[model samples]
Structures are given as structure tokens and as C-alpha cells.
Target: MSEIRTYADNRQPLDRNWLHKQWRHLRLWRRFLLQAVVRETHYRAHFATTLLVGLVQLGLGIVPILLLFGFTQEVHGWSRAEVITLVGAYQIITGLMAAFVAPNLQRMTEYIAEGELDGVLLRPVSSQLYLTLRWINVAELSNVASGIAVLVIGLVQSGASPNVPQLLQAFVLAVCGLALLSTVWSAMSFLAFWLQSVNPIGFIYLNLVEAGRYPLVFFPVPVRAFLTFAFPVAFATTYPVQALAGDLGWTPVAGGIALSVVAVTLVRMLWRRGLRSYASASS
Candidate 1:
């Protein structure tokens, strides 16, 4: 009777633990998203230049895509319109970075350096969440607008309009692409914990991401295989754009999604493990 009672008590705690974990994930996502709303209210009143500069940068970035169709019918196997749509999807990721992930993560390194991250360790919420949600950038919305314009132009150029089914498929791939790109960015930023300097590392990763602008096909098989399998920018950039261009079928999309999930999950685990090594200057 005592043993059975003990088992029941143990199982009760296990059930509560499961619920706690579920609630934690939900809370984390909610907090992160809500931070954007708070940031927007703060920025619109305090920092109008942030919005203006973001718009200017976004415009410069989109010029190549926006005017590409007029310059040439196509580049390599990708039409000017198709490449623009791909660029649009890529720009959505850029917007997210300029607006949220990059700015926050960069600030996080400061927290780590100054010992502020130690306070986060005492919070009921995860230290990672605290750091990630510490601030928001309001300028990223410009990238979103620019991306949409490029997408519209690309669709018009595709000659045959995408039906609803086709559009839905493209969206699914685009979302996955966004997630994959964010995953790469986060993983690289988190490497600051181990290396103690992120400026050099972050610049390297940014340059690599820039390479995604060109079609993967232009690269030889060895490089293509390396990026697609060894690194994963191909999944984040190449496949989704190709899907929009109608060059990739469902298989490549599925492959990209699967690779993204596996890579991001692994990176999350690694980041947490690295956190154990974090010893802030303050605490």
C-alpha cells in the first residue's frame, strides 16, 4: 500500500511537470510577441529616425529586386520576377532581424558582458527568454512592406498567375524558410557565450547569408551539396525561392522543412548547454 501511494505521488508530480513545461513554452512565445507591441508604442513616440532609416535601408535593398524585371527577362534559370519573389521572402527574414532578433540578440551579448544576465538567471522565466525579450526594434516593418511589393511584382511577371493552391504551398515554404533563417541567426549569436566575442562571428554569418542572393544552381555540385546539406542556407533561401519560381516541387520543400526542424532543434539544445558555461561579470 505504501509503495502504491509513493508511485501515485511521484506520478502526480510528473503530470504537473508536463503541464509546467507546456505553460512555459506558451508563456515564452506570448511574451516575445507582446514585446513587439510594447516596442512599437515606445518607438513611434521616441525614435522616429529609427523608422526612417529602416525604410531607407529597406528601399535600397529592394531596388535590385524591384527593378530587376525591367533590366533583364531572367537571370540564369530564374526569371527576373521569380528572383524578385525569392528576394521578397528573403527580405521578410531581413525585416525580422532588423526589427527583433538581431537587435535583441546583439544587446544580449552586452547583458552577458556586464553581468545583467545574472539577474535573469534568478527569474522564474528562462534566462534565454529574458534576454531575447529585453528590447524590440520598430524599423523592421519597412522590410515587410518592401517584401510584399517584390512578391507582387514577381507574381505578375510569372506570366501565369498562381492559383490559390499554388499560393498556399508557396506560403508554407516561405514560413519554413523564415524559421530556418531565424534559427541560423540565433545559433550564431548564441555562439558568443563560448567565444566571448560576437562582432567578428556575427559579421561572418551575415556575409554568408548574403550569398543566398544568387541562385544555388550557379554554384557547382560540390558547393551546392555543401550548402544544402552541410550548412543549410539552401533550405532557408534557395528552395523557397525556387518553389515560388515553380522550379522546385513538393519534395524539396519537405526536405527543406525537415532539415530546418532538425537543425534548429539541435541548435536550441546546444545553446542551452552553452548557457551552463555563462558566468556574467556581475554575478
Candidate 2:
């Protein structure tokens, strides 16, 4: 009884310590987001201009789909509404990437090139977390809202009243899509450690992500395989839209979740390897 009591007491401290750490992390994240909000709102005119430009860009993105559908009622059995939903999903994913991931990726390149990463390394928190979450483009969040509006419009137009289960699946798939894209972006950013100038790679990556706005069925088998596995951008937009339509099967959903997990793990491993090879500016 005494031994069991001792074990329980020891475990209690461990559990409390873990919870405390989590609370601290949450607080730090909140503080960072708040700072971002303040910084973004400081320049009100600039914020409005950027927001307007973003909305215009999003609106223009839909034009291509409209033109394509105007020529054909359906492309590979994907109706206009379905295609619009895919585009909306693409917009949402890209908005998230721009707001959260792109700024950090650009900064990471600068840090690596200028050896400014040393300051980040000295911080007590995880350097990756600090670097990635330190900045938020609050202005770009409006694009996410616009994307949501587009998605709803498409769903309503298509007359797709997804049941609760289908909606839940779509939500889960959307999260997985975001996670998968984030990991891919991180992997690309890690290339900065070696190349220092990854502009070409970044350009190619952006183009590939743009392709996600369309269904995979439009591509040839080889290209489909590549998009499904090598890059997996289809998981970001196509799969989620299909889930909304109740057309996605459990196997693909499971595969998407598993792929996201694997991608995250691989990217983390790549980050560690890059750090090992990182020659600090100070060094």
C-alpha cells in the first residue's frame, strides 16, 4: 500500500508538470496571436488595401473555373458547383499557408542566409515553433473567410446538404489537408539550409499547389499518381470537396490522415538534419 501510494504521489507531480507546460504553451501562442493582431491593425490603410487586393485575387481565381464550365457542363464528371467547391477549398488552404506558413518560410530563408537564426536558437522555446508561429498575417485571414463564403455558395448551388457525418468527415479531411500542406511547406523551407536561394523551388511549389484547385481526374494517370503521393496536393482540396459531396471513401480518408502524419514526421526529421548541417552566421 505504501509503495502504491508513493507511485501515485510521483505520478501526480509529473501530470501536473505536463499540464503546466501545456498551459504555458497555450499562453505563449495566444500572446503571439495578439501581438500579430496589434501589429497588423496598426497600419489601418495598408491593412484595408491588402485585404481588398486579396479579395480581388480570390474573385479572379473563380473566373477560370467559370470559363471552363461555360465551355463544358462538366469536366470528367465534376460539375461546375463541384469544381467551385474544389477551388474554394484551394483558396482556404492557400490563405492559411499565406497567413501562417509563407511568412515564416520567407523569414527562415533570411535567417539562414544572414545567420539571424542564432537569436532564434538561443531562445528557450523550440526554435521551429517560435519561428513558425511568431508572425501572423491577420489581413490574410479575410481571404479564409472569403473562401468559406465561396464554399458555402458552391454547396448551396450544388444542392449538397451534407449530413452531419459527411460534414464531420469533410472537416477532418480539411484539417488533414492543412496539416499535409504545412508539412510540405516546411520541407521546402528546410531546403534553404542547403541552397540558401530556393526561389525556383518555391515557384514550382506554388504552381503545384495551384493545380490542387482542379480535380485529379483531369490529370493523366502518371500525373495523378505523382500528385496523390509525391506531392499529395489533391488531399488538400480535392479530397475535402469530395468528402463534402459524400463521394470520398473511408480508405482515402484514412490514407489522407496517415499521409499527413507521415509527412509531418518526415519534415521534422528533415528539420533536425538541416539543423545539424546549419553553419550559423556567428560560426
The models' CA-based lDDT, in order, is 0.68, 0.84
* Model 2 C-alpha lDDT per residue in residues 66-111, reported as the tens digit of each score: 9999999998989999988887888888988888877777677778
- Measured with C-alpha atoms, the lDDT of residue 161 in candidate 1 is 65
lDDT at residue 68 of model 2 (Cα atoms): 91
Model 1, 68-146: lDDT tens digits are 6577766676776666666666666666666666777776567666777777788766566566545556556666777
Model 1 CA lDDT for position 272: 86
lDDT for predicted candidate 2 compared with the true structure: 0.84
Which has the greatest TM-score? 2
In model 1, pairs of residues that clash are none
